[model samples]
Target: MAYPQHTTTGMTTHPDLTEMRERLERTASSSGAIAVEGLILLTGVYTAISPWAVQFSSQTNITVSNLIAGVTTALIGLGLALAPERMFRLAWAIVPLGFWLVVSPWVVTPTHGARPGIVWSNCLAGGVTALLGLIAMGLTVRVARQSPR
Candidate 1:
């Protein structure tokens, strides 16, 4: 019996398995874009649903506001995840979204003003969203700087 050679040759040689594995490892790493995108996505979802989660849906205006912001944030997160190369710059926009979420209780509250639960919920969600946006922006900037001009 003859043993087949471990190597084969072709016009396109076998891809570098080590390099491919390394790339897969990098892509699946916790710090990778997918992970961050997931965080952003969750943040948006929480923000949108906070009115119900925190039981402040009685305030129609605030509920609507949160729904809008949450949906928008989720969409942005999705865009970033799906087309990061094109949408990375939009990360900066998230900073403002975060700010809006933070202040939405005040701005979107009924003339009665904001409830404590609403205030706290918006603040927390907004802060997290803003922080995540900042992280996304920082990552984008770092990647840009590292890329060859």
Candidate 2:
């Protein structure tokens, strides 16, 4: 798993040649996290627009909640993706956000009727978010364990 590197002296180097190729290994491992972060961001955007897209914008309470949650989730995903070294630990927080999304239909007041579509949409998105959050947490733990301690 040798990766190309350029030295200050205009020379090529293969740091992966070292006995402990931690940096290269870490970069390789982070691909999954990057993908998950993108999915999380997409979910957030979907959640935010779901109320209108589903024709349930009348439910102002749920709409507002979803908007707030969606924006926050997107921001967190962006933060983790852009600054994993400093923000990976924040990944765990997204789990609770997912849980909130899952239960939001019941928690937030809706306008006159119970919309099954809204419930299902949130549940589906939330379930995916929470599942990915768990996976991210596991990967973070694994990476930490693999680091020289």
Candidate 3:
């Protein structure tokens, strides 16, 4: 598949060909590590804010399973940040997160005291986090495929 037409962009974008060439040269000179670092940073921020500010953590609503998921996210976030170059390939984790973020309102189904705002906000947060993960994942994968290791 002749991709890269739209799906990927490095650290540079230009309106003209000459500027585009220069931007590409600059990005190619120092892109791989920076891209991975950006991805890890995104994961870190997402992990930090999600459980406290984004979750519906009422005593009645919060439970053991959610705690487990939060713990799991912490571990995964650590992995992504520490060894982003290696672990970044395991990017499919974003899919479920994306799914949940997109459908959290329906999934939560708040009956009595519906926190639709919280649900939507958290869902959107998760979706944005997943997007960041995907960007890093795809970029690292592309670079790996293009460059010999």
lDDT, model 3:
0.52
Error of 1 at 12 (Å): 27
Give the candidate number with the greatest TM-score. 2
Tens digits of per-residue lDDT, candidate 3, 116-140, equal 6556655665666567556655655
Residue 68 of model 3 has an lDDT of: 40
Worst 10 residues of 2 by lDDT: 10-19
Worst 10 residues of 3 by lDDT: 59-68
Greater-TM-score candidate between 1 and 2: 2
Q: After superposition, how far is residue 83 of candidate 1 from its true place, in Å?
A: 1.9
Candidate 1, number of clashes = 0
Evaluated with lDDT, which candidate comes out highest? 1
Off by over 4 Å in 3: 1-55, 59-70, 110-113, 147-149
Instruction: For candidate 1, write residues 1-149 as lDDT tens digits.
Output: 99987865663555654454444334434366788888999999998899899998888898998999899899999887776666777888888889998888778765789988889889999999999899888777665444222
The true-versus-predicted C-alpha distance at residue 92 of model 1, in Å, is 1.0
Compare candidates 1 and 3 on lDDT and give the better one. 1
For each of the candidates, the C-alpha root-mean-square deviation to the true structure, in angstroms, is 10.5, 10.0, 12.0
In the predicted model 1, the residue pairs found to clash are: none
Candidate 2 lDDT at 93 equals 84
